[model samples]
Target: MNGHQIGEKVAVKVGTDMDEYSKPVELEGILKSKGDLLGYLNATNDKVGEVCTLSIGNLDVIIANRGDSFITINHFTRAGVEIEDYDVIVVKQGYLFDELSAISKLDILAMTPGSTYQRIENIDYKNIPRPIFPMELA
Candidate 1:
């Protein structure tokens, strides 16, 4: 209900692998907020076949069934959602670019500003470690 529509390109985080005869899990309950326990929404899996895009790092895959949101990396068998649908797909992963390079047109490292990815020079060290490489080079 976040205004997301079908056929829109999006990248989603990798989910657990599904088996061939996996059953569709359904849920129906009130999503409550923390502390106050106030009800957020009366959530249910009524619209099972609604289309939505799953976003990874730079890649977006169009998924028709809501169940397909938890899709496998196997691209050969999946219908509708194909690699050709995206120009530059970003799969939010690390150290696996080499394996995916065979099917990719180009690869790029898209880093964003965050505490986890702050530059070394910008960091305020509590205690300076002895004999650091780049930190003590200049």
Candidate 2:
């Protein structure tokens, strides 16, 4: 709906690893293009450096603004272009600052693949339990 509100057609910019969402997703503004979100954003903001994004994947990846997320333009500021309206704000972090925490009623932690991914599974355990998943799946 965000794109529709702004009159910009949206669609996944077909890429290799982007098939995770192979099925259709409900959105607005209509599927109109096939390109990378970063590339498009970069092209659109070619004259400026204020727009930045954080992508954890490599290779040709589909791009869409709706149902997508954006991080801070710089590393030390808020996570989005305008984050003053969201009720259940979702920011990628293990913790929150004092100011953001003050207005929040509850906080939920959704663990994602990062430096602390898979916990004990990713660690080198020479003496722990045996027959673990993935590593020991045979």
Candidate 3:
């Protein structure tokens, strides 16, 4: 921790409570968290080997390992951390929060393959109008 280089080690800073995730000891990858955020930090550490997680009370937690460095903060509005300090910071949120957006030099939306219910569909209506949108605009 004292003498480690970035990228040379895996450093993850999680901003949510681990208890909510229910980290399984033998498995890897996130099983919950509403399909958002990388919920596998706990078990995923096993694959990396010797991954260290530092929990700063309930507000945050960090996982650090040797060889590769990456952060996983559950909260997008983490102003406590000077994101500019890191070479590459990955905030797994759809859009950057105001706090992070201010200092972010290059923010991007990295969408993974999953059921994105960004829109509602495939539902049966007992009794409703066929068309919901107005044909003409006023």
Residue by residue across 1-138, what tens digits does model 3's lDDT show?
A: 335432232333333333334232322222111111222333342333233333233323333233232334322112134334456666443465555566668887765322321233422335866574543234
Off by over 4 Å in 2: 1-5, 12-81, 115-138
* lDDT score at residue 121, model 1, on the 0-100 scale: 68
Point to the candidate with the largest TM-score: 2
RMSD of each: 15.8, 11.0, 14.0
**Which ranges of candidate 3 are over 4 A from the true structure?**
1-82, 114-138
- By lDDT: ranked, best first: 2, 1, 3
Question: Between 1 and 3, whose TM-score is larger?
Answer: 1
TM-score of 2: 0.35
Task: Put the candidates in TM-score order, highest first.
Answer: 2, 1, 3
RMSD of 3: 14.0
True lDDT of residue 133, candidate 2: 70
lDDT (tens digit, per residue) of candidate 1 on 38-138: 11121332233333344444544443332322222333122334546556555432323333576666766545323333356655567767667867864
Q: Could you tell me how far off, in angstroms, the CA of residue 67 lies in candidate 1 after the best superposition?
A: 21
User: Which runs in model 1 stand beyond 4 Å of their true positions?
Assistant: 1-82, 92-96, 115-119, 123-128
- Single out the weakest 10-residue window by summed lDDT for candidate 1: 31-40
